[model samples]
Target: MVSLRKVPGAHQHPNLPGKVKVEEDVNSKAVPVDQETMPTIIQTVKEDLGELKKFYNITLSPTRFQKVEHYLEKKLEELSNITFGKLNQAGQVDYALLNNYLKSSLQRLRSDKVKDDEVLKLVGSFAFIIIELFEARQRIQKLDFQEVAALFTRADNSARDLKQAISSGIFRGKIERTIAYRTAYKLEELSSVLRDWHNFYLGYEPLYSWWVSQPYATFQENLSILIACIQTDLVGFDDSVKDPIIGEPIGRDGILADLDFEKIAYSPEELIHIGEMEYQWCEVEAKKASCEMGYGSDWRKALEHVKNMYVGPGQQIYGIHDLAIEATNYVKDHDLVTVPEIAETWRMLMISPERQKANPFFLGGNTMQVSYPTDKMSHEDKLMSMRGNSIPLSRSTVFHELIPGHHLQFHMIKRHRPYRRIFDTPFWMEGWALYWEFILWDKGFPGTPENRIGMLFWRMHRCARIIFSIKFHLGEMTPQECIDFLVDKVGHERATATGEVRRSFNGDYSPLYQAGYMLGALQLYALRAEVLQSGQMTEKEFHDKVLHENEMPIEVLRALVRNFPIDPDFRPSWKFYEKN
Candidate 1:
């Protein structure tokens, strides 16, 4: 992994009002600044910015940098009245000030250089810092006990909101294009920072060693709670549709042709088989845990309690009694994919508790770390552990979090070199994951009525998430109201609902899952039709091409489709698809 160097301190910005001077007599380094020399700050800022622009080669022309300098200068002038104490002492960096600085800088660049790519990239970098400041403020706000439990939840939601804004804004196109050009560079920077954070705070190796080694149980408990919260809240919630063909048992010719699955260095059938075994293993573990925890004499009671506790009224909860019947019926009625690729992938990845603890983002109550292998089984572990009867609601979470969703989307993006930007764009990554839930069903794994209901239950959860995110962030509802709405509308347990509300307060990113899922699916469906009708491609060919090309913005996808050569006899007008 590439690592980014640490950004210099605030005083390092050459444009600041003072310069360090060595005083031999006093044997001290002092910043010398007086009214007479103050004008130099502006010139220095300009010169420094110029150097940065040149170093990055942001554009072939110096004109873009010149424009940015002009705007930055004006912003600094405006901020002159804004005292550092006032801006930074609010316990956080003032985002309003940061936004003003960014806006001014971007506007100036836009006026001078019409290249959307350069302007958007610079804007994105600036926005990243501003977002970090906002997040830091949020973290500080959670210093108290009550707020600490909610911190991770809030961070997850905030990330979703920030990604959504970036995806939907007018700047998305430019940002996407520019990101494609520089994602690797940025990822390197992020990796370095993450390493430092891990070493300094999380402690390397043995998973949560730092957390466990803490002298105070309160601290450990707090960390554990935060981890649990994030895992439950943020890991899996995509709303996009999967390509039925991709999930087929025999594997479609189109999929084969498009992907060198052969080159993936794994067999699809073997993958699915392993997933099934893992699933069964998880079921056994859950039952053992439940029995030990004493949910009831049998696993059935524990399963029931888990369902009633987490599932909302509108969703379906398939009991063990219905499992065999449903499975047999589904196999008989549906064109089931024999490979079980998704299931296999999830089972292999989620069985280890160590893997669960490594991911900080998976801290929430119902996170994939806790839910995946156990959803379909009794809460045996919880029972054996003698903990509360809180079964993970979205137990099939690994399906959404790892294989056939996030993992798949991420790996697919990495496959195509030119479309690497897709990984950088959270919207594409998240939206694609959400869309896969329905797609898996459509491909025939969950075909019985019971299975369908179970699937619908998951969908309802996502829908509720959408409503909650929009209402909560837009101020249409209070945090309490949000909690009530989730419970009343989605049938979530009070504890889960309350967790969701608390999480919402800390961030604004939850809405993107629904929006992206819905929009991305629509785009894929329409694009598929266009490709098919053009007689230039088969379903397999189109899907192969699309997946192989990676997770570009819908607009970019459309452009690529339009440019794809096709037979005149089969050609279809692009007018069929509606833009969001």
Candidate 2:
């Protein structure tokens, strides 16, 4: 489901010239380390380190890298205080100092000449290490919902800092700028929504307090700075630009100029109104549950009850779940021919609650376990309390997250040979899940009227998000307007809609949700056509190829595919893979 876009022109990494020669001479052979040879403990440690290294190399910006280093220093210091059998005082100090030196080395590279592409490549190589570190930190932290929420706030800040740094140093061309700008605007809407959400959180002071108590102070502080930088840059853009669809400045008049607007069955205003109502309905349901459960009830339990109430005995909800299961079964039935290694590796990856706490992005909601390939006895015992609840907007989300989504993606990455780093792109990761939702629906799995209604509702939600994101970023709407849009158009309740709007404002990156999903779907459709024309592979083959690559930006996927060697005798057909 990764969206593919060409970079337009080849651009070399800034530091490539100096390092290429040296790197070429250092080590070129793919290390062939046997997974079975190493002791279990050592192997686990090695894998963890590898994942951490990968993440650091790809995504670490100088500002964020420094933050991570500081965090590590603090953590090591904390460990020093705890009583442990593994190491003496001197050993602990040595460990801390070693980490200090490693961080310092990474810091020194901040100024080292390197091309953006090269940096991306380096990140890919060491992404596994970053993943491991992230997972490990979560496991050790045992973070709850409140703590996870705080981390998201911090993540937003880190993201801002990275974006600002990149923007200052690099001049993206007009096309790239336009794309980035539009995307940013969408994110702004999402942030506004999130802010509303924060306001709602404030209503429950105890929960809010618990969230603030997490180790996110630094993240929040840094985020504030990052937001300022973004705002400054955003203010410079001209807002009265002419619309492409209508040859006039984008405004109420411009929207009226489009012929399609009149032809469409639903008006924009109508859609927004629907969204608002749905949101309110959801809120009413939540409030009723809250009162029943008591004011200080466990948020997790409360959320589960709410989800179940929403799901009810509807075909739409149940059908999507069944479709998701079918998708998982298809993969299992074929042994995932295109990516068998990934299928094999699924049995080894464990989903720990601590890890979920550490990474807000991976938090499991309303599910006893969100995502785990191997259901060991331990996992089985820890049954998730949130199963068979309300249908999340993303249909593929259930399959991808719980059944085949995360688990399948992770296994593919682990087993990939000459592994192209695909896990580096969050956009594609989420997009894949969303894409699967529709894929199942299109396959006729969710055929009931209720399921259809649910699907339409979900679509409406996404559309509202897109519109909200665009209007807010373009300065066409206020935060309140964004809230109104969600509540009115998307069928969200007033309170819930308001919360979503606030979330958009405060979080600032929610637009990526729609952008990623839309982009992924577009690219997948295009790729299917390309493969058919070439007559080189079956649909199943292409699908396997796509999944095998795991989750990567569309552009990166295209590059890999363009360079991929396919059998000349292979005849492309959708039927290669089972439809159902």
Candidate 3:
């Protein structure tokens, strides 16, 4: 989700300033005192790595990969030299995090190299020429306009050849076809780089533009044609279609690699099973709510009733505002978690029709953007948008975006152990918000059957997310299948379902992101059970401790909160979920 700090047309509260105050609250009991040493070397390593990455910003270059790999190797050596016993618990935590990041970065670089190699095979001849031009520009080399023109000419011919070769059916299978589609996008990116390089000297250096203009134009056209051919002929993409989702699954091995990076010990198959189990639970709960709504076992009908309970046009803002106020009051009244004064103040805005395609609901961090029907939308789209952001649905989502969700999290991380910001995982971020939903449900926040159905809708959606997202990445489900699953199983509106599926596999979010909500919340729920149930910490203390620790893998936070002995090479081993 895109975080909006300031919006031009946002409805600003007079009390909430444009610039938020993020200073430490010394008198606040919410924040725990830092008793452990700060890892200064980790900061140094971070800066050094930042400098290295800034210089080698090009994507998928072997030279870039090798240089980065070498840099990480040296950092690993430096990390190994640190004496684990000398550091405090916090320092040891940073050490473990850095170690994990270095190892994961290295593994990802290697994996990327394999994929890049395949992509280059499809676009290498022409891409290499453009890459050299950019590299030379980066080095401040004098432009050889005539030679550049010749190079572009060669690239244009090469692109044409490549397109013809691909169209000849050499790349026929699903795997090869997926690679070809990816190659098309890579060509689009290369064209952008070409445009930037051309615009850099187009007007300033007259001779350079005059000599290279025709060739550049020819090559850009050729690249576009090649890209279109790959999409249309090879990938069977139709431009007439709206929001065509062409997702390439990474398969089980890639999913395993991602899980390893996130310190999740569970297998992808096991996670899907967990999703199924959770879905079954939500179904039972939904049926109970449906019966209370006089709809018997047909929760879908109950869901329809809730959807139609949406506020009228131009009235969504008030409903959303009231929901936020209600959630704020509930959390504060219950002493669920420490609510920062700043988190309580947030600006509200309407998501544009364009952005609504990707984010069809509330998007919050510092600001909450409500998705509602606009004057420009068609009749059907207007109705879909209204139903998707209905009062009952917005009830559960408001707090998830504001208050104890992303909004409070933004302020909390800035105030506490901000350096651990690099180790931030969606499991902690999205999971914490979703965890609040679980807490609220248990605390009877959903007083009405409609509200419970609404809550269950999102809960089941998260479950479906885990199932569809994992299955998609495992090559067992397509994007359309995922959308259908959301509509059929979770009772989402079709347009809303399309947007959710599009955003999931649109390459913006991590493969595990959708799964993170429920899985991450479940981890926290389990920890809450372990801590509060055992009488080690009160509810407020447990919640406060998590916020103070800042962001890291929930498993790491688990070890920290449990006061487990810190080790330099700690890996996540807590099997938080049981099959039964």
Candidate 4:
């Protein structure tokens, strides 16, 4: 059955988020039940944490933090008791994933607490007062309405006073100002939490309402005003410039930790080098395409020409539909992978002007959303939209969104070992879609030189993402620098480049999300070569096997596909790609 699910700590706009899995009729004798790989303890811990998180909803609640930490520690001890060597291959994979998940969760909780403390230092005791109220309410303690009302008054006055200090140049340094801005956002969340708690008892308990209603309203208003003040005065961002790219650079250590969590065998520098190497290959191929297009060696000119090849106004959707059909037929004819008829059936929708700010391209699953000019857009914006979603560019990725990309990926995952969905990584999800682009390009799917350029352009963009995103997280690249890199290096439209950088650093995505596209594709590409060379599986079987295995780190997937022995203490040691 279809159901709404929350990915724990999923805070970003994913590459292809929100695809509803169509239920499979497993009652049919033809449908075989997939083997269960997830260990019982892993499932139990996942379920327990999901429940605990629902009740402990407050972000900065000390009680919630303590309980989660203790719970994780207990779970770790229980997991350690399992016999790792006795488990089957899939069971071993699950064990490793569970161990990593438990450790990573603990690390994240501790890290979040450190950040919360830093933000609290800037925000003051007022935030803690609001947190205390939520905690007390959750405890079902008898309300001391007058005392609680007095606390709200103190919080409101203190919040207003803090705003005045910030206005008077209290936080002058850039780092201090950044912290203040973060505190402002944290206070905004606190304001919402307080409002929820306030509404819970607002009119339900007459005594509480009489004593606390006005104070609660006053405190909430003061919190909003403070948030606005921090945004406008400290951060210099108002409504007109609402989406300023103020990303939190996780630094080198953070990047290293993230790499470990993703089970990536390479170091941050090595990954960037891989990106650069791949980018250089794209550049060489792009020059060849440019030459064929009569643009000499200057690929930028070739890119501009390709961009201007947009279909007539109001005809973008039909072009997309035709491309989807073409791509689906080509894959089926080639026997690349099985495409269920249902995967080909997708409804079309137009992206809103606002969403186009972050995702200025196509997104697909059960529904394919097209990005093109609308009547509400300005002339310049409309032109940019059309240019960005040109026929050539769209052709390169039509299959990436539909058919062998997101649509097929989502369809197969549901019918397979769906319980492993919790272990999903962008490296597999986005990487699988991106890998098709590589294979199709190798098979000469990009027919014309302009089409080749289109494919190369996205390949170059993916490589650039790896560079800029990794560098940005490692504190080597600023958001503005990243935008400039895309524009100057990858031949991106200035507006499109800006949107990309904004999306990358807006804390909506994990640090390595952008890098996942190309790097992930490379991982899969290497695996395919290994599998084929060893005669382990034919081409079609290799492709189909991946989808049925559901989502995991590519490294983990590699171990599964290759039938390598996995241990409970498994560390990522597979260097899938070697530098040429």
In order, what lDDT does every prediction score? 0.38, 0.41, 0.82, 0.82
Q: Cα deviation in Å at residue 351, candidate 2?
A: 15
Tens-digit per-residue lDDT, 327-394, candidate 2: 66765665433434435232212245344222211222224133221233243222221222245423
How much is 457 displaced in model 1, in angstroms?
1.6
Model 4 scores a TM of 0.90
Q: Candidate 2: deviation at residue 431, Å? A: 1.9
Looking at model 2, which ten-residue stretch has the lowest summed lDDT?
Answer: 17-26
How do all models score by TM-score?
0.39, 0.39, 0.91, 0.90
Sort every candidate by lDDT, greatest first.
3, 4, 2, 1
Model 1, 1-580: lDDT tens digits are 1112223342121211122121122112222322312224333444645555543243422333544455465545443443333322111112222323334346435543544344334434322332232223222221122222233334334444444444445334444322322332333333333334334433443333432233223333333343323222222112352210010111233222211211112233332233234334334544554565475334445544555443222122232113323433343354322213432232222333223212211222122233222443345532321121122434234355554455444455555433233123333555455455555555756433323334444454455554554444343555567668756654454545554455444323332333344334445666666777888776556645665655444444455555643221121233322321
Against the true structure, what is every candidate's RMSD? 21.6, 21.0, 11.0, 9.0
61-146 per-residue lDDT for model 3 (tens digits): 54467667777777777667667778778877888888888888888788778878999877777787776566555645465677
Clashing pairs in 3: none
lDDT of 3 at 203: 82
Q: Candidate 4 — which pairs collide?
A: 12-508
User: How far off is residue 530 in model 2, in Å?
Assistant: 2.3
- Which parts of model 4 have CA positions greater than 4 angstroms off? 1-39, 139-141, 174-178, 236-242
